[model samples]
Target: MSETSALSATGATESRLVGVTAALATVCIWAGWLIATRYAMTSSFTAVDIGLMRFVVPFVLLAPIWIRKGIWPKGLSVTNGILMIVGSGAFYTLMVASALEFVPASHVGILLPGVMAVWAVLIAMLLFGERPGKVRIVGYAAVVVGVASLVALKPAGVISDDMLMGYGLVSAGAFMWACYTHAMRQSGLGALEAASFVGFWSFVVMAIIALFTGTTIGDAPMGDIMMLLTAQGLLAGCVAVITYGLAVRHIGSTGASAFGAMTPALTALGGVILLGEPGNLALVLAVVLVILGVMTASGVFRRARI
Candidate 1:
């Protein structure tokens, strides 16, 4: 090949590598967030308090971005803005925050990847007449089966009334996330714009709730407090969101969501390593199935257009 052609190929390969690295980093960020959120829950923080902290950290970290873009949205409507805010902001945080108190974040880390994908696909089909191909259908089925194994058919001793309720709530939270993701995609907001708006509105609502409830805010040991806030703001909030937004731009929502399926297994591993949680072989297998099923459903195996 000519030098020009060689240079072109080299650039393209670099870009692809960058995308993969960024995507993987996003997954790791998510996994760490789950673990930290679980630890933070053990403190005096209520669900809303954690939610508030999550946003507060990110809000401060991203203040420059907001300042550059300004607080006000240029062309957003009241209705769409509200939907975006409620869907992505308060409800999403509330569900996940309360969930960490009850269920292992590893469970959530695993459950959400496929759950969100299946929710988005099914909702779109039912609401908009979009249909999954045969591969996608089987993939979706695998996800359902895997999820059942993970949540419903765990060892008999593991199931309890409270655990079941927590599972149900987290599943509902995942559904809300699916709604939020789909709505934001359909809302015609630029990715960065939507992310900034989400941060802003989540901050607004979380602040309101925190003030109204008089919930204690970040009163833990200063190190723990700083660590949680830093994780929330830097890793989970700013970095993960930006990477996820960019991944969706490069790979589209379904593909990015599919790649996200690996997070649960990673989260489980992290929990085992960091939190000293027992790793069950059966749970590991189930999480693997969920991740595989999501990848299959996402059609990432198909060749990308040049």
Candidate 2:
């Protein structure tokens, strides 16, 4: 190859490598967030309190950057930004916190990311007229089967009405995230811009809700509060958002999203090690199936084969 062509090829390869690294880092942060949130729920902190903290710290730290960048989205971008805030911001956090109360971290790992992958593909098909090839079809089927197995094979006394409600809420949160991602792609906003916008508006909305609902961050242990503030706010809220954006920009959304398959198993393992949550045969099987399905549906494996 010509020197210029070789240089271009090298640049493309490096960019994709960076994207993959970012995607993997994002997954680890998300898994850590799940574990931290579960731990916080054991303290005096309510889900709303945790959600409030998620926005508060990030907004405080990122506000100046947002202003300096002059990053106000307009028109449909504005609408999409609002959707992103509601879908993946405070509302999503609250849903996750509440769900964690009823279910274990393992369940959250499986349900949230698993449902999200399924929804992302389904929404793309329905709204964007994207046709799934044969491999993708098999992948989708595996996702469905894995999710179903999770529900059906949950430990005894874990499938009560309240737990089912929690599952539904978590599923809703996943769907909202999928919507936020779609809007973000459509809005053409940079990752930092979108993250800052969502953080600012999420703080505003959560502040209003806290005022009306009398939701206060009760006097929890200082360590727990600090952990929540740092993990949810800085790591998952700011870092993961930006990195995931970079992943999408460099590697395409489908390829970046394929990394989500690893999240469930990682979260489940984290829960077992950190939270003392039980890991069973069913959870293992579900994780394997879901990861395989996501890899296939997102065309990661197919692309690698090519």
Candidate 3:
């Protein structure tokens, strides 16, 4: 290869390396956050309380920067700001947290990302005129089927019927999150700016709610409060969003999201090993279908072939 070509190849390799590393980090944080959210839900804290802890610290920490940058991001549209609130802000937090009381984190890991990926493609088609290839459509179909089977089928008694509500809520949350992903992609904002946008607006929504309904923060145990503060507030709320934004920077939004196909495996294992949650062949198969489908829908193999 010519010297210039070699230099170009080296730059591409480094960029991919950085993107992959960031994507991997985002996946780990997402999995841990699922596990931690599940643990909190099973304990004394309500989902609302979890939401409070999740955004409180992030809001406070990012406040100084956001105050200077102003409330709305410089170039972000009003529509995207609204969609983002539904996606990563108050609505997103409450939906996922509420589901955790009934849904296993393993199921969450598999289902939410799968559904979100499908929604992303659908939204892209509707809003941007983007079309998925046949293979990608097939992958989307697999994700839908996997989600259905996971929710409706329970031959081995792996999933509880009571969890149906949880599954429904998660599917809805995935749609909202997909909207958030697209908004983030179009916003032309950096990682920190995106984090601040979601954090500030979401905090406004939640603060309004707390005023009317009151808060459970004072009633919860200090240890649990502190634990969730670190888990939901710092790591999941601020750090994960920022890190995933970095992945978006390096790899493009679509590629960064494909890394979410890894989430089910991580959270499923984390649930089984760390939390002693039950797992069986049925759950395993469902997770496989979801992962494989998302990978294909993401054009991961197609791009690799090129």
**lDDT for 246 (candidate 1):** 72
Question: Candidates 1 and 2: which is better by TM-score?
Answer: 1
Per-residue C-alpha lDDT of model 3 across residues 1-306, encoded as one tens digit per residue = 999999999998999888889899889999988999999999887777887888888789988868988888677789887887789889999999888888889888888899898899989999899988899999999988777766434565466666888988888999999999898777887667777777888887888888887887898889988889998889887788777877888897678867878899999999989888878776788888998899899887777788
Per-model C-alpha RMSD = 2.5, 2.8, 2.7
lDDT of 1 by residue, 183-299 (tens): 776677776677677788788888887777877664557777678777776678777877887776665666566668779888888877887666676678768878888888877
Model 1 gets an lDDT of 0.75
The per-model lDDT (C-alpha) reads: 0.75, 0.83, 0.85
> Which 10 consecutive residues of model 3 have the lowest summed lDDT?
151-160
lDDT of 2 at 301: 86
Candidate order by decreasing lDDT: 3, 2, 1
The model with the greater lDDT, 1 or 2, is 2
Report the lDDT tens digits of candidate 2 across residue range 207-256.
88888776646667777778888898999879897788888889887788
Off by over 4 Å in 3: 1-17, 151-153, 156-161, 249-255
Winning candidate number (TM-score): 1
TM-score of each: 0.90, 0.89, 0.89
Residue 144 lDDT, candidate 1, scale 0-100 = 83
Model 1 residue runs over 4 Å out of place are 61-72, 151-154, 246-255, 304-306
lDDT of 1 at 108: 71
